[model samples]
Target: MYAVFKRELFSLLNSLMAYITIGIFLLAAGLLLWFFPDTSILDYGYAELTGFFSLAPFLFMFLIPAICMRSFAEERREGTYILLATRPLTSWQIIGAKYFACLVLVVFSLVPTLIYGYTISKLAMPAGNVDTGAIIGSYIGLLLLGAAFTAIGIFASSITKNQVIAFAVAVFLCFIMYNGFDAMAKMALLTGLQDLFMFLSVNEHYQSISRGVLDTRDAVYFLTLVFFFLLLTHFTIGGRKW
Candidate 1:
């Protein structure tokens, strides 16, 4: 698993497209947080990263799929997945290695954004008036969200040999996971089931965690989402063999 992880990570690092994608994510984030008049934190007259936190998941909807689209799609396209499957590693191990590798790239994309928090802190009244707890909670939530998205992306990749198709499917799934339930919950006809829909929505749990409360339910929801998607990926690859 470690060997596969290392190789996958290095492969991503060696790809120019990976760098471009990460760079685009960071650049877009910076522009939204600092430059865009409507979304800019500076214009909001607050030290909080509410705007950033709100905008990030939307950006991630595209960025993560792009990162993971090549995971299995590229392998299968080049006929290298068969070679990979013949290795000693179990399906879970292979999936895990690829998932973690993609996740590490997500982490790398996020780590640079810490400077946003620090800058906000320094810009705050008295040199540090920002809500530290909220910022921490939001970061944690973002990480979990990214993890779940990575799992979904990996699962999408495992099902298709075309990277573009994997990307589109992953994006569609992520959007639905993040917003579809909440939308359905809002329908006048679904009032009776609103609670259930909200409970299943990724945005619901993400918002709960972003409030700096760190509820176990929200954490479990995210972990379960990640696990469920990964399990799907495992079944996907296994089915290809049979």
Candidate 2:
């Protein structure tokens, strides 16, 4: 498993995929939080990063797909899927390795954002009385959402051999998971299912965690979403052989 994981990770770094993904993420962060003066998190009266956290999910909608697009799709497109399938590794091992590699890529991009936190601290009136609680909570929420998006992207990639198609499908699915449910909830047609839709929506849990409140329900919801997509990816790969 470690060998497969390292191989996937090295492949990403060698191809500069990691660098490109990180660059895009940083660019989005800078544009949304730095260039926009009106709604930037820094402009808020409180030390909380409400604006930044709220904005990060939408940016991640595209960023996570870029990171996971080529994970399985590139292998399949190059006819390496057969080679991998014939190896001693199980399907789970291959999927797990790629999943883990994508996760590391997400974390790699996120680490640099800590600087924003540090800068916000110093800029705060009391030399670091910033709401570290909320900041930490928001970061946790980001990680969970990233994980869910990565899983969805991986599943989408597994269904197609073309990287571009995989990317497009992944982005569409990511957008749905991130915001589609909430939008559907607002529609008059689904008024009766409003509670169910809102509960199933990713934003509800994301918002709760971002407020520095780590509710167990939110954690469970994220875990369930991640597992559901992962299970779907596994089945998708398995079905291809039959």
Candidate 3:
């Protein structure tokens, strides 16, 4: 797992995909947070990172899919996925290593955005008057959400050899997972089951954690989402010929 993780992390960097992915994320985020007039944090008149947390999930929805689209799909397209079976690594390890590699990139991409938090802190009237707890909680929530998305992306990649198809499927699935359940909860018929639907929703749990409560249920929900998809990826890969 470590070997695969290191190889993937560096290989993407060597190919400049890592730089491009991180750059795009930062650029889009920076524009909205700093440059764009309507979305600028400076105009918000408050020391808060709310705009970032709110906008990031949507950005990551597409960004992460693009990042993982080539994980297995590229190997499969080039007829290299078959060669992976000869390695001693278990299917789960392979899936996990690659998943973590992608997750690391997601985390790495967020590092540059820390500047937003710093800027917000300084912009506060009292200087450092921001809600430290809330910011920390939101960052944690984002990381968890990103992890789930990474798993879904890798699973989508595993199912198809075409990178475009993988990206589309991953984005679709991430959208549904993130918001479909909450949308369902609004129906009068599902009102009684609203609790269940909210529980299933990535957005619902994310909002809960965003409040700085650090609820275990929300964390568990994200973990469950990640594990479920990784399991599916394991099966999908195992089904392929050795």
Candidate 4:
């Protein structure tokens, strides 16, 4: 498992697509949060990094799947997945290794954003006036959210040999998990089911953690979602492709 993890992680780091994906994610996020004329921090007239937290979830909805689309899909595309299945690893371990590899890259993509936090802290109306707790909590929410999406992406990749289909499926599932429930909750026809829909949404749990409360339920929600999808990936890999 560790060897598979290392191999997959290094493969991602050594690929051009990985850098392109990271660069695009950071560039779009940075511009939207602090540089774009309309949405920039300058326009917000505030010293908080809240705009970033507001924007990153939407950005991650696409960025993460782009990185993960090729994981199992590309392996199967190039006929390497068969060899991978022959290795001395359980389906769960193999899927876990791939999941962790993508997760490491996700963390790599997020670590640089800490600079935004530092800058916001010092650039506030009063030096260091930022709510450090909320910022930390938001960061935790973002990482957990990313991990959940990675699990979803790997599962999508496992179900198909087409990277494009994997990307589309991952994005659609991520979107539905992240916001579709909230949308459903707002529907007039589903008004009575609002609470249930919201509870099923990853965004609901993410918002709870971002509020700086660190609820155990929110943490469990994220872990449970990740586990469910990874388990699905293991089964998908062991079964026939869709």
Best by lDDT: 1
In model 4, what lDDT does residue 12 have?
A: 95
Go through the candidates in order and give the C-alpha RMSD of each one to the true structure.
1.0, 1.6, 1.3, 1.5
Tell me the deviation in Å of residue 151 in model 3: 0.4
Candidate 4, residues 98-169: lDDT per residue as tens digits?
899999999999999999999888888898988898999999999999999999999999888899999999
Give lDDT per model, in order. 0.95, 0.86, 0.89, 0.90
> In candidate 1, residue 38 scores what lDDT?
95
lDDT of 3 at 164: 93
Which 10 consecutive residues of model 3 have the lowest summed lDDT?
Answer: 10-19
For residues 1-242, could you state the per-residue lDDT of candidate 2 as single tens digits? 78889998988888776687779888878778867878776566666567778888888888888888898889878888898788899888988999989988888888988888898888788879888899999999999999999999899899998888888999998888778888888884766788778888898899999989999999999989988998999999988862
Residue 35 lDDT, candidate 3, scale 0-100? 78
Worst 10 residues of 4 by lDDT: 233-242
Candidate 3, TM-score vs. the true structure?
0.96
Better structure of 3 and 4 per lDDT: 4
lDDT tens digits by residue: candidate 3, 1-242: 78888987786667566578778888999999877888888887778989899999999998899889989999888987777667888988888889988998899888888888898898899999999999999999999999999999999999999999999999999999988988888873855698788778899999899999998888888999899999999999888783
Residue-pair clashes, model 2: 0
Instruction: Please give the lDDT score at residue 153 for candidate 3.
Output: 98
